[model samples]
Target: MSSVETVKNSPWQQGARDALPLLGGYIPVAISFGLIAVQSGFSALETVLISALIYAGASQFLFIAMVASGAPLWLVLVMTLLINARHLVYGPNIAPYLSNSRWWPVLMHGLTDQIFALAHTRLPQLEEKDRMGWYISAALIAWLSWIVGTAVGAVAGAEITSRWPLLGEVMPFALPALFLVLLAPRFTSVQWTLTMLVSIVAALVLKLMGMTNSAIPLAALCGVSLFYLLQAKLKAEGEIHG
Candidate 1:
């Protein structure tokens, strides 16, 4: 390939480019989040700050909903933390790939679901020296997109939505659509399939029982526990047969 193509395909460029798909999803969802948050009675500044500080996608919406319902601050905090508990698993799983980089701690702040997903698939393909730069490039782009999108929605979301009601209806689906895209490829194994099924059932049960706040974290915990048990059982069976 030509030098131009090589330059275009550099790890940093590739990282930024790879994040483009996530950007497509994040921007609209973030915009929707901003509009919803503002409509829910948050000021523009408050909405932007939430996006900047918390940076949790669906959890931010949940936070707004809980607060609007007059739920206590402590409950909001607990629920938000529970919803984002999966980050604990994400960090450890991604740590090995980033061991050589001193900046991983700072970079860890950018570890959202999409970034983690991208890192898992893309980091292994990059050279060691290139991984940090690649991650930084991708994470930074995604972060900026979210922040910018939020600003746009906060500043003009009311006007925009008034003129285009369909956008208001459709934008909320962007986040879930993005998640489904990320998850679809992982359904290749029975372990993953079973784990997800269990998680879904746990969530549905919790939701039905009026325990929606605990559903996400509890379901995640159930899924992770089941996956480990399956792995252990498989290992034991192999040993016994051997």
Candidate 2:
């Protein structure tokens, strides 16, 4: 009915237009992270090595900050692992779609918010091979750009630090903003709106009750199960009305 809808329906289009956002979304965060990594008193090579290997951006930022703050190594690990536990869920969820691709595990190691959300929404229209190819291309390009961003930041971070007292300090909050952006559009439904409200309530209750460690997992469980039950019940009622 519209030009945008027409493009979305085209079979020949590769859907790479959406990929442009990832560069801007990732550059500042990655550069800030690289600068922080270097400034945490780690050698430049050390920062380069770890950022390349441990591309889990959030965990890397947390680890360096905790070390800088003199927090225990074990405490940092536990917190990082907890924060990154969502990746564990993502692994199994995407496994079915990627199971037949060559070296899917390697491709999966590059999965991030942009790649995962884009692929989930865009890939079903394309063939399996193309789906895998599109996702890998998007994710890998984003990763390479991140490394370049970090390099630039490492070189410029000192200037920023002198001016802003650690502009890189804001790097840790970027992933949460990324998460919110990815999921924000999906909140258009009433059920999803309620689920988010419930999850927030549950999280606050758990924190106030001193079950802080359990807050995230419990909130996730309550939200997902409630949404699933509501959907099922609504479907059954629709069937009866029909």
Candidate 3:
């Protein structure tokens, strides 16, 4: 490619292009969320604002559900924080590739589970100077798609669902399907497989026990903690054997 072409189709542009597949998942799920929020008595504007401001997929659904159920704001806040605490791990893992960019704190707003997964895989292969641009591009596209999807859902979700009831049922699966797509490639070892199986079992058990609200976060914590503990054990055994 010519230098001009390269500049025109920069890493930023590539990132946005790479994020296009996310729209298929993000839009439908976001629309579902918008519909649910609106049906739950939130105004269309509030629905859009929630997607724009919070942008925390499943957590937003949980937030709306909690609010509708008259859960206290403090409890809602705690649950939201607990669900998103995985970001602490995500941010640090991606920070090295950011090359100490001053805009990181601001850019971090765009971080999401899918974005983190994509960045973890792609960033290391990018030129140092291109990493931030690519990240910003991918994040921006994903964010905008979500906001637009929410708006559509807030405005017309009921109509859409009423016309195609099956869509309403299927929309909920989009998020989980997207997650499986993102994580499937990483199940490259016994450890990863075991961690995922454990997490799945934990989540299922929690849900069966009527701890649905805590299942996701607790299960995620269980998986991550187990992976780390396994890693530590392996390192110790390797040192002793060496």
Candidate 4:
């Protein structure tokens, strides 16, 4: 192979290293999804299909739960889409690295919070192409694992959950917990920290007011936009002081 080809194909250990902790977190959550699907009236085939195809845990949960509760099809569709609205922010944030990759579609579809956090944290100084490869490999593995694990859980779900009552609750907490862990290093930046706090508080406030997932998109926009303006004000003040 040409040196250029070799260089392009060289493996990034950082991606796999970063993905390990994430792999630990997603295992049970995937299992939980499988169990939930079965209990909620989905067959094993259906569970695997949703996990592999829909591929968004929270949205799938909300979608199936709403449908099982006799929610209108339109409402379920809106909720599913709205719950996943956060993806809009994720794409452009990583676009520079991925747009030039050999596998843009794989990166876009496979990338998840675990892989995103891992790559973003480590790739500040790496070339875009290297970062893209690192992130895509890890994210794709994670996505495939989730589907595979869900399929396993679907097969043994009744036995598994019966022995572990907490499975239902613990599995769902995985993603949120993983996010908190990922956010730890970013606390050094006051502006970003404040922005995250504002977004969280806004989401919770909206939830308290009985806003469904549909309204969360707007709440997040308002909160993040407000933080951006506030940060600008602070930067202007700092410049004047300087």
| Candidate of highest TM-score | 3
Model 1 ranges off by over 4 Å: 1-8, 68-70, 165-222, 225-242
lDDT by residue for model 2 (52-170), tens:
77777777888889988999989998988887676677666666666465688777777774677666655544556566656666777777877877777677866765786544466
Clashing pairs in 1: none
In model 2, what is the error at residue 33, expressed in angstroms? Answer: 1.3
Query: By descending lDDT, how would the candidates be arranged?
Result: 3, 1, 4, 2
- Each prediction's TM-score versus the true structure: 0.75, 0.69, 0.78, 0.75
CA lDDT, every prediction? Answer: 0.81, 0.70, 0.84, 0.71
- Report the error of model 1 at residue 54, Å: 1.3
Residue 164 in model 3: shift from native, Å?
3.5
TM-score, structure 3 vs. true: 0.78
Kindly provide the TM-score of model 2 when superposed on the true structure, using C-alpha atoms: 0.69
Residue pairs with clashing backbones, model 2: none
Please provide, for model 3 over 111-141, each residue's C-alpha lDDT reduced to its tens digit, 9 standing for 90 to 100: 9988887788778777898888899999999
Which segments of model 3 are wrong by more than 4 Å? 1-9, 166-188, 200-213, 224-242
Q: In angstroms, how far off is 119's CA in candidate 1?
A: 1.1
List ranges where model 2 is wrong by over 4 Å. 1-16, 160-189, 196-219, 229-242
